[model samples]
Target: MEYIQVLELFAGLGGLHIAVNNQKDANIQVVKSFEINVNAVKTYQENFGHDVVSNRNILSLSTEELFRQNVNAIFMSPPCQPFTRLGKKLDVNDDRCNAFHHVLKLLPRSPNIQYLLIENVYGFESSKMRDTMLEILQSCGFYTIEFLLSPTDFGVPNSRLRYYLLARKNKKFTFCKHDHTSIVKEFPYCTCRVKSLNDQASICSNCQREVNTNISSLVQQNAGNAAQNSLVNPGKLHSYLDKETDIEQYAVPDKILLRYGNILDLRTFQDSSSCCFTKGYTHLVEGSGSVLVCSRSVTIEEAYKVYNEFKDTDSEAALKSLRKLKIRYFTPKEVERIMCFPDNYTWPKDISDKTKYKLLGNSVNVHVVTLLVALLLHS
Candidate 1:
């Protein structure tokens, strides 16, 4: 049996590795993985093995060295901070971007590589780096297709809109519904399409609030002004959560709940959506992610009513009222589930929760990447 050899760059937590392993129809093997972060390298080794992943800096890899691997495909999620909206918007100028730039330099010379996939924050589509990348790939006789997709497009409840570029040497993308020039929101002819709660109605039962406008704007800009028609049913949050667990440690602090509780996105077990969880998840307040209301007994509607009643009148009393809902942060394991990591994926026991959150936040959505991997190989 011939196996597809893949090289993973910026392979933090091995998201692409997991995706390759999930392919049942294709014999895909990740021959090598490169990541610079030591802690991430440790976690990758824990789940995968020491032989596959390397902590060697990507910029140091020579074209000859990459060629020696004889990989047919490449998967990469480059340093997103340089391209994220909240960052300096350095594009190709940021020091952190040097590694990806180096890879662009290597690609033209490394003829063994045929299929290539690159993932980054949504802002990357408009960057100079993207322009340079396309130029290089085109020079190498590769046909490329771009996408700005979210996990929701693949039936996962999490909304992590990312930019993806898929290129294959000498072969054009043949998706029947899409042209190569346009960035797509959903996979062609995907069967799991369902309307996003925000698209159809509000995320809350009583609130008329819309989805985060920042994310909505991103979707509009990258998807060529087409409104998101592809959505997911989300099924239930319960599927991603533990059946039962002690809740004391996971409870939101009273001070935090009182100060920013009204603004925090609240999700219930029965509901099907969540905000994107970032590296600042537990440490930051707004834009981090949604907090889970652990109990179905205290309806989210009722919780809002309590906030309105005493929110301005008595701060301490509002804290007491909100506390009744048993609101808490999602466990790291739950975040992994939301990110669509396999049940067998594990972290080193010595890794702190903070480190776990950071690594997972920096990682890719496994389900989304898995489908992309399969599509690229089969194409």
Candidate 2:
């Protein structure tokens, strides 16, 4: 009945908090969470209790004060904009990185914290800040493991490739068979098996060839390829979708569909993969995420073919053809499901859809982090 007390920083919508609290095998509690964005704090408070998250800037918090809370672990998904490809690669010089840099300065002073998990964009591993963090962690007597992983590597249908660094104070990772310095692409363990749609008793043939069935080997390479890694068996989008009464509100406007319809990443009812959903999910079309075709009757290829035919034709004909596909943005609820937030996760009634998308976009994938937390806390 021992509980592991956790402290979460940059706690956006409590993604890392949810991941920590949901570990069934471990009795854990998120003692405190720090977030600066008011909308994010409001969303976190709505889903978790009101007392959980504090609207405090991490740079302002004293390590001595934080350590006094006696938290055994710290989990953070610092702002990735500074390291993301879409932003200026400012690295440590980015003013946004100041808070994370402050935390690094505090780490050496907090001797009570045993476990640390940091989540960031793919580019973070190569950053100067990463180098500095590693130098500090090594000086503090911690064994560290880094990963470049995606939700698709697990059972989630979306591809959100992220960098994670796990550090244990004076202890090696329970599953660290590979070099700690090397970035592991797949989960260190594999218990997922996608059952054959055709044969209930057999694993899918594609998975059979690509995924290693052996767990002791600690390898699950290329499990992120949703189309090819049928072994990982990321289920289709239908399971995550909501039964909306007024679906048109979420549909791509006629103007957008006519202008960007051909470029839209469209997924049919049966498709297992989707692009990374950004804060610009509903607003930006090309790379934000995939738009779902509402009809089960229409295949993705069919929708694409129609768009192809209309690509060069008159605008009126293009508009008519696109509407038939019934393509729409994924609802916020659907986005939450794919992000691996639990069924009970909620937002305040006052939060607009745009704010919801923005907060969720800034969050982490719960299922992926949950598994990583479990491994980090293994004693």
Candidate 3:
């Protein structure tokens, strides 16, 4: 009657917890989730209806007590700030990385841990912390498999490349010590890229009506029977799109346009891909993400005509002439849909829109996580 007891550390918004809970295996249960972000904790509780221990920071968590509880598995996505390319490469020196370091130490203290999964941003695999991580896992007698995977490879349109390490205790996982390059992971099926409105209208030779590449179409390419099989194509991305979303509120403000206006990413209703979004997606518009435009897709060259005209003028002035594009921010619901959260997934009603964007940015891909869970647990 042994059940799977897991500790989800640095569990932001319970993304890992949700994935584990979604596993078909009836024995798996999250024993404790450690999170310090109050907003994330609240959002996790709202959606999960479970209590998480957040009394102290992760480093302060009582691992000695956890050992007594016989926790067998650990799933962690510790802070990526110290390892991210966007920030200074402080690695283990950064205070944010201390929690992850503490977890590494906690593992030896908790000997019963047989399975471990760690995820982080792309740059994490190359950072000095990675070597330390590999050393710790090896010394702990855990066979480790590492890979860099993106949601796009799994038939989800978004491009978010992250690092993952799966390790099992006392397992003969084969690996060459000299080989350190990460392989770009791929799935069995890759879907057709969703063509944007302008790209479709302008490039398509057929004058007839086109399909509004919805979620099913995006997933249908790869998943003949997603309900029964094919972990990659979890075909429900469009379910969470807000039918009555406030377009104006999500629209980028004029001030935002002044700095980041020209770099618009007008995705057609049928588009299947997008750039990685960050916590500052709302505030930092340029490299953060693409927006959905309601009007005919104007080529960047065409938009540049308007942009060049108002390069010196206010961004609002430039936008005045470019109103036909009908640009708007991807609604929070849409963002959630892109992240592959279930349609019924709910966040705190009172949370700020910025917070919503941040939460979604910080969260992991549900499909990707679920697939990894199924593979590792064989559920």
TM-score per prediction, in order, is 0.87, 0.88, 0.81
Model 2 C-alpha lDDT per residue in residues 115-191, reported as the tens digit of each score: 89999988998999899989999988889999998887766788899999888887877564676788888775543
lDDT by residue (222-338, candidate 1, tens digit) is 221012323534446777887776678888888888888878888988766789999998889888888999876777677768877888898877787788899999999889988
| Number of colliding residue pairs in model 2 | 0
Models, CA RMSD each: 8.4, 5.1, 8.2
Better of 1 and 2 by lDDT: 1
- TM-score-based ranking: 2, 1, 3
Better of 2 and 3 by TM-score: 2
Best by TM-score: 2
**CA deviation > 4 Å runs, candidate 1:** 191-232
Ten-residue segment with the worst summed lDDT in candidate 3? Answer: 222-231
lDDT of each: 0.78, 0.77, 0.68
Each model's number of backbone clashes?
1, 0, 0
